[model samples]
Target: MTAQSAHLDDELNLKALSFHAQPRPGKIGTLVTKPAATQQDLALAYTPGVAEPVRRIHTDPDLAYAYTNKGNLVAVITDGTAVLGLGNVGPLAGKPVMEGKAVLFKRFADIDCFDIEVQAETPEAFIETVVRIAPTFGGINLEDIAAPHCFEIEQALIDELDIPVFHDDQHGTAIILAAGLLNALELQGKTLEEAQIVILGAGAAGIASARLLLALGAHRDHLLCVDRQGVIHLGRPDLNPYKFGVAVETNKRTLTEAMQGADVFIGLSGPDLVTPEMIASMAPRPIVFALSNPVPEIRPAAALAVRSDLVMATGRSDYPNQVNNVLGFPFIFRGALDVRASRINQAMRIAAVEALRDLAREPVPQAVLDAYGLNALSFGPDYIIPKPFDPRLRERVAGAVAQTAIASGVARLPLSD
Candidate 1:
């Protein structure tokens, strides 16, 4: 690393540890919901009173929602194989990330969380672990686990569990990116069907994004998924089953080759992999989502310097069109939990995307402008997605997802009388 970069890393470590250590050793903790001051209150909270509700719930399992915090409680789980850019740091090392997610869950949606880190040997082991503890939570959020395994674990959990089992690293990023892409394309006078797209990083986020976009009417032939080696094509023997399903038979060999005349570029890969020449090679008014976190595939300034006509987004908060998953997961789960949804289905996801798309096109709130320290903001290239702190996200996104769950018949607690 450069001297400046190394210095920044050191400062980040020092300040981060200090802040986490200050008031407490962690970012989150539990608070009691009921009063237990007197002897009578204690008796009702435990012993005989607690047993009556326990017996009732034993007879009718669904009564847990009425007796406890299960309705609003979500579990943030990780095995630590893919914690941020720090890969495979182990479950214990991933606790801070899970705690950060818990903080976001509470801060954004008033959801209660129990962050759990599992030290499992394999995918089956992890799946078994989560399933064994499933009854304690209203929903399960699988996080930071590596790919192929993440896909398998999530599918199994969703198949076996009644409550929502969302893998945020995949779908959260997909939902937010889809919303931003819709607005970005609309502004550029482009459509998903006709847009030629290239995606770097065929991991969880990348694969999920390709499929979600396809579900949204993006042409199969118009997109290509690429990893470290090159394009995931039909002839590539190394392609995973997920990649094989999305792969196209194409002659493009490298990212540079794929970018040539492409209408959209998405990077969930490493930083600095993209160059000005590659950005310049894309079609006029291109849409770019360099969503690699901590740093992006290309800095917005560098990409914009190549083509001022393009709309660009990054994973950084400092950028304008940040594809932050915080904009989706919290409220999406809020909706799912509110209606006692069995799962977060495709219709619910599309609803969130549409809500975010419509929200971006409307006038920006003064609170949002102040939050970002901007004097004024409008619907344009610079603002294609709603900021995570925007108050409307809770109401709009949650309501949309909840309504879709109800409409789709996945909700057990019917909202309508």
Candidate 2:
């Protein structure tokens, strides 16, 4: 075999070994920057001069950022119950995903982050664990925790912690989906409130997305929540407490009948739940978000085959209108931490959606196309958002988040730039 063939074989072997070995084995590591040159330098750097700055921070708390890494640091915390599309993988198994999130935080937002896989047996216990470690981090990013419980945990953390607490699974997915939906709706000449929408799942992303769509001005009567048992309409005995609450708030038309003729279909459920016939049944030029990871609720080819006037998005990157949460969370947290935000309010999230929507309207940058290795990209029915590799994310998305944080009165330090 050729040398290239041998190299490929070796790479494959390493990957195979990694599956049995730890997914990501190491804990946090530190690097020393300024070396202690002489005894005088050592004394100033280690003890004497360090004391002076420490004393100043004691007098004024905001100086902590100036003297330490507090401004740049973010804590990526997870109970690991819900690991991506892979459900209920334990804390140790979820470390790789958390580490991936930390890598994105560093790469996309220029933020320093550490992944903490807390093995808390219960929801209340998990909240306590996060709160105890809260001071060490400037901001907290909750990741991969399971639903209903995720909702409670997020609310408790935001209420308890002084620093910003964000659940990427919930709000991150919601923000990106909202941005895509906004652009897709406009392209189809439809208004958000007038559209009849259906969501297939009621998990973390689904619940958050439903609430966010409502906040974005979609009428309650126009939205439907469908789980394992048909649609979640009022008087449904099978609905869980969480699903039941949403039912009371939405789907007022007694339209628990079927998925036919809905203006939009957003599936946070598993693969192949929606058929081509269902897509054909939707209103003319319907928008669809089949956001199941690894496999979508309805394949793009099948969806397009049914309705030529459709705008479809999925969580997978290979397709057009990829609605991954990576597009929103890192930049959202970056903006919040930059301003020392107290919390990530709806305004900050909506601002991110608006920024993402605007990005679709502009001419796709050469850098963006090159990153994706595409010959050309355009603004139209097909192309709606920039791929994750687009470099403009650092400034554009973060800037909008920080501005909204300040305007909404949640930011302690306003954005200087």
Candidate 3:
């Protein structure tokens, strides 16, 4: 193998080995909210004063937000069926990603998060288990679960629980992706209705992304969705309910026929699926988001070389225009939890994308640049998002979401200035 190939292999191996180390399975720590100094302080904090507040909350449940930590705590729950790029390593192996998500919640939004891994054998049982513990949290963040099942699980949780329930893999990816596409379309001077978007995956992220794009006025008739068995045309013999719904909404001209003049190629499929020839076949200046993890559906070099005018993005952090969902989830949930939102409605999600896109349009903050150990930050085709350490994310993105949620009538409690 070439030196470059060897380096890639080594990096992949190191990542795999690191994940395999079973030393620290999950992370949960306590934070002191009230001072315990004397015996009098302990009595007030624990028994008598606490009971008073509990009594008040029982009479007027809205007082819980004022008295307890429930207003700021989010449950980052997972079943470990779809752990990032690893894909179904089981519940124990998935704990690390859930914990990492909790860390991001604290770092980005000032929200307290608890990571819960349910080792339940079935999706229905898992959903039931989460619902039982739902009241303890202000919001629910479902992560890395597989599709179809994830769709049902999120729907059930949202119906049963009063707090917001978000599945990051599906909606988070969808939201960031929509933001990027909106910006990319502006850069190319095109509108969603005028574009022919061909999606190369029909899983959780793909379906959610397609739905969000369509809701943004992207022409459903002009969209085509393709899965492993090739394009999902209407009346296909073997297609699941979710895939079938996607098939019916998209590919109005039929999948095989629509690819002939497609304006955008979005691949949430497995690695190395799109060839140089496929990209060459696209319309001039075709926008592509090859958003498969670790490795994209089409490698950047090959895609760019074949169509120099093409705008491309991926799920990997190292690449330009990464469509990673981190830009959305941490702050989205933060905003929801901050204002005590009843649910994450479509309006809130659209507001989040708008905030992210607005942030991308501005010159990156000097503080964020300094945190990255750089002197300056600039917005360009290559730099469309703030790095994870960007301090402005909480105030900018989360605040926007909270404001929008209030306006959209989903917030149960508003934050004090």
What's the TM-score of each model vs. the native?
0.98, 0.90, 0.91
lDDT tens per residue, model 2, 120-189: 9999999999999887789999999998899899999999988888998889988999999988999999
Ranking by lDDT: 1, 2, 3
Q: Which of candidates 1 and 3 is the stronger one according to TM-score?
A: 1
Better of 2 and 3 by TM-score: 3
Best-fitting candidate, scored by TM-score: 1
Q: Would you list the C-alpha lDDT of every candidate in the order shown? A: 0.94, 0.85, 0.83
lDDT of 1 at 383: 92
Sorted on TM-score, highest at the top, how do the candidates line up? 1, 3, 2
Worst 10 residues of 2 by lDDT: 249-258
Q: What TM-score would you give candidate 2 relative to the actual structure?
A: 0.90
In model 2, which runs have C-alpha deviations exceeding 4 angstroms?
A: 1-45, 238-241, 248-257
Q: Which ranges of candidate 3 are over 4 A from the true structure?
A: 1-28, 248-259, 372-377
Model 1: residues >4 Å from true position, as ranges? 1-6
**lDDT of candidate 1 over 1-417, digit per residue (tens):** 589989998999999999989887999987988899999998999987899999999999999999999999999999999999999999999999999999999999999999999999999999999999999999999999999899999999999999999999999999999999999999999999999999999989999999999999999998998899998889888877888989998998899999999999999989899999999999999999999888899988899898999999999987788899999999999999999999999999999999999999888899998988999988899999999889999999999999999999999886542
lDDT for 145 (candidate 1): 91
In order, what is each prediction's RMSD in angstroms? 1.3, 4.4, 2.8
